[model samples]
Target chain A: MSRSDNAFNQYLDLVRDNAAVMAKGRPALLEAVNKAGASRLAEAIEAYKPASDEIPECRLDRLFAPDYGVNIARVPMTADVAASFRCGVPQLNSLLAVVANDIFRPTDVLMRNMPEGLTVCSLRQVPAEFEADAAALLADGADKNSIAGAISDALAHDGIYVRVAPRTEIEKAVQIVNIFNSPVPMLTPRRLLVHACEGSKVKILLCDHTQTPAVQHLNLQNVYIRVDAGAEVEFYDIEESSAATHRLFSFRAVQHSDSRLTVNTDFLSGGVTRNEFDISVPGDGAYTSLSGLAIVSDEQICSDSVVLRHLGSHCTSRQIFKNALFDKGRGAFGGRIVVDEAARFTDAAQTNRNILESPSARMEASPQLEIYCDEVKCSHGATTGQLDERALFYMQARGIPRDEAKRMLTQAFMVDVIDNISFEVLRQRLHILVEKRLSGASADCSTCATACHSQAPEE
Target chain B: MEDLLKVENLRAGIDGKEILRGINLTVRPGEVHAIMGPNGSGKSTLSGVLAGDPRFTVLGGSATLAGVDLLGLSPEDRSHEGLFLSFQYPVEIPGVTMVNFMRAAINAKRKYLGLEPMSAADFLKTMRQKRAVVELDNKLASRSVNEGFSGGEKKRNEIFQMAMLEPRVAILDETDSGLDIDALRIVAGGVNKLKTDQNATIVITHYQRLLDYIKPDFVHILYKGRIVHTGGPELALELEEKGYDWIKQEVDNEQI
Candidate 1:
């Protein structure tokens, strides 16, 4: 048998082994998964095109699920572990003090850690008020035919359902912490669904972290967000996994009239990460802003594929993504803005900028605009280059060392994205984290705990 | 009095094209020296070479600041050796606050001198004092370094930095290029206030208007990469009145 066929069969057999999960799933979800599975087989037989032609081909083979046993059982959160769960990072500890938390160890929810307005349970056990919305989101995602989407629906056993009450403003951010720790290679998947009711305001922080660095794992995640009229939501996604882990994320958001949505994705350190975004503004006077930053070195890879659709008049969308790659690191950004015929007076802008710290590092960026309306204003730009030598020399001339100058310039290059964050404390924390990452300091939260303890001068 | 800045037969060029050819000059402490010449006479090139700009190759030269070999040091080391060059065109470093930039510079120099970093309160106090000398706005001091600053504000910032560093030898390259009369008076006044018996200033300008405010003890007319004439402060008035035509003819005739 050919390699592609063998790979397909291996995936099929793995799914069959988890037949109980399929049996427990919704009928529509199961049918969609089955059809998605058939399409995947055909694609394997024919070598289908990647999801986005502008970006580097997605290596589906690398995404094949490992048959190893996953740690689905809840790891008992000891008092000591709970006390040190903030990873001993000063900024993280300080930021966590004000935010509510929902901690997930692998796919198991820590019930004691659940905050108000958040429900974490098995997919089949979602609350009655949110079950229909969650099912609809999954069913719509299955129709998208993305390999990760299909796999997420077929294998994800746990779900997080959040409902922001109407006219209620959440003062503190609600943090969803996904912790991955296993001695052996395994697959972990979960679904997150958020519904912000009318006139509600909320902020969410999603942190993906790994406990160990030597074990290989795959973190498959899906997020669905819906904002009602006049509602506002801000979501920050931070990924700091180990070199042996791969993170796949599929995110979708729908906005109603006069709603605002802001999403910030920061990839500080990871082995491989592929993020897909589909955000639609179907109501007038709605605004959407998506910003991302990726700081990677070694053989790390970061890719983002985004599609922002304007289906209503007087809607606006803005996107800015920046990447700084070193060593043999690679990055890709494929962003598209589609303005429908009815979406008159739309304002859309997209920008992707990258800096390659080494000659071997590579970046590919493509910004596209598809506007069918005449009254829309759309602009897209993409640029990839090295650090500014003149700026570096200027700093050095001012008595700042070359290394420090480069760090300052790099931080400057990324500050604009971080500055747009509505939360002041979180913005400051990210600034510190980005500086640490640029200075070659280990940014891994798991490692930082030990380092901080050993290096605490006052302690 | 000992010479704070001494250069002997300094020859430099860029991209294999020679600019400063066998130039010599010296400045003693407490003296303000004005180097005047027409455009393309390598005025900026001389300052660039002295400041160790990597773009200009020092073909053959020897420059010393406080008896330390200037050419052999990196730009930052050159700075540590008490040589400061206010760039002809100041660069804008976005997102780096002026306060942070000045603190880094001060701490770097302090480190080179084996001293501890200034405390936050002390640094801000010093910044406030130096900023007052230049009449710089508090808002500008807190913003990014020269980002979105006007030409006059940039020059004021340069002098403000000079006051902070208190270098042994300061080279002001075209500090009056874009300044109005009032701004020129303020900038030159700032330079005058910062001058001391332990330091020297080199005011490089095209016109002698700036020299009217800050008197120069000695003036040298540079032509075609060489100092063809040296005289007292009156030499600046002479060049300004004659518009460099007479001096150009004299130098060109001598070359023939």
Candidate 2:
């Protein structure tokens, strides 16, 4: 793109003609977009087209609005945050270059990657209030480089960055919803700069809901992750895009020697969603775990996961994925464990399991290991099969109706990843979701064979 | 009057090996009938078939419970009809808590009898009262079904379920197998408490040890798949004292 290209189009028009700026004048909105070169935000949002018809109303726009008090300037910062001033070769955003995404991405590379030429309409009711706090974020952002260009490099050469300010000591959670009504397929790249202080923890939940009709194209996303020392960070994504949707998310992360990072994704509703997590531990005693689960049903909701250990001794990484198929849904998982020569004494495990609930349902898992380091403990395995008929029989013989029996056993099969959630409320809520999906999709559930065979109406 | 359970010319086995060959026995309500046999005898097979355990194929004859065609029903159907099998080896169910399993079983029986579901309060209250009958630890009632339970504890839990079900026919298949005297008494006591004139019990034990506590008015020696001798409760003493050798000799002599 030429230096004088549409680069500065949205902002130049607004700023060059400053009078009407106040008319569109939502302070918080200005603050969120101001820290970043407004030109960069405008171009990214301009090209990102969301693919899906049937868009549902979302509350994210209101959530990020100035009335939501998205003050970037006044938010406090710490030594680590102050260190983020050098977040890049040149620190571009302060709590106050004000910007943008994955650790939510370091500055705003995700916005820059909206599928080329596809216009992703920003969710409406835009937030008008934002206190520029790039410096405040610099005060709390990672002392190390938080303006990660790795992801931007993948999709955009010059790339883009938006400096974001921390609202508080985000402990236990960070929930966000990205709604798309673009009606066209797009590729999105997100870079994350998460710097959790010692003994701190956080959970980030991203809900990607599409309200567009099925476009026969695939959407792509590249996400980068970073966690500081002694900090525990959790990343979760929920995809409710309906049948006829296909998307792939590229997850990459670098964790410090002692920090813990976990990335989990769930497919409650999706047409065809494929996710890959490639994580590395550079810190000694640092750990990275990649785990996910999906209910594979008709159309396509396939998940693929990959875990890698780059460096750091005593580092443990685990990857587990489960898929339960019903009503002709197809699923496949291919996993690899790559251990670098220097990353010795690392304990790693990878397991992929798939269950077929109907004769028409199908699934397969392929687990691989490419370990270059010897004397290092690393392994990978995979298992695939239909539900245990004997287990079903035993459960049925105990008076549990057949469908409820399948639900229980299928739930038990997926219980490993779920029980590890470490939160009671969320875990139980997940079970409820699982129950609803399995029961809603499988009419044969809870009923015996005679009923199921007779009930099949040749649909 | 018809006895509670009657098995005539019962011939059953697994994979073509005959275990119970033409064994005839009868059990009446209010009576504890103990079947004492050697290791390979058909003691467990009878209980298996009675409980509708699908493992064995009944090769011959018939088994009737309370004048109903007992062998024709499914295991769960038989159970709902008040037939209980305190398994020699109880199945371990993980993730399914005891309270939840019990609730399901209780509701299944209630629904079969055309009764409404039990309120949570009544279920819990009944659980509390029955907890004392089987002498179960209050904590265990909330744990997963029979998971990580001691051998004795598993048996007690079986009787505890037996108590909750209040079956008209309970086949205690080696209920006293792993228990110390105390647990044995507790299990037997639970069975005794759930006893009624409308119910009958078939206590299958390898030794006479369990028979002493849960007295049986009728004792039968099941050997080589047939009841060689039947008499009063004293038969159990005779077998325990003389062992199966004399009985085998008597059979051989009679056959010759």
Stretches of candidate 1 exceeding 4 Å from the true structure: A1-8, A20-47, A51-58, A65-124, A446-459
Predicted structure 1: lDDT: 0.78
Evaluate model 1: give its TM-score.
0.90
> Tens-digit lDDT track for model 1 on B1-256?
7878999999999999999999999989999999999999999999989988889999997999978889999898888888898888899999899988888888988999999999999999999999999899999988999999999999999999999998899999999999999899899999999999999999999998999999999999899999999999989888877899999898898889
> What TM-score does each of the candidates earn?
0.90, 0.71
Give every collision pair in model 1. none
Local accuracy of candidate 2 as per-residue lDDT tens digits, B153-188: 999998888888888888899999889999888898
Q: List per-prediction Cα lDDT, in the order shown.
A: 0.78, 0.61
Off by over 4 Å in 2: A1-168, A178-200, A208-221, A239-241, A297-301, A326-330, A353-363, A379-398, A441-459, B16-18, B252-256
DockQ for each of the predicted structures, in order? 0.71, 0.19
Question: What is candidate 1's lDDT per residue for A1-459, written digit by digit as tens?
Answer: 465454345544556665555455344433454546545654543453445443342365455534544433323322323334443444433213111111233221234444455444444455677667666766554425565565555454455666777877766566666666566676776667788889988888887766657887777778888899999999999887788878778889999999999999999998888888999899999999999999979999999989999999998888999999999999999998999999999999999999998999989887888989999999999999988887777777788877788888888899999999887777877888888889988866633322222112222
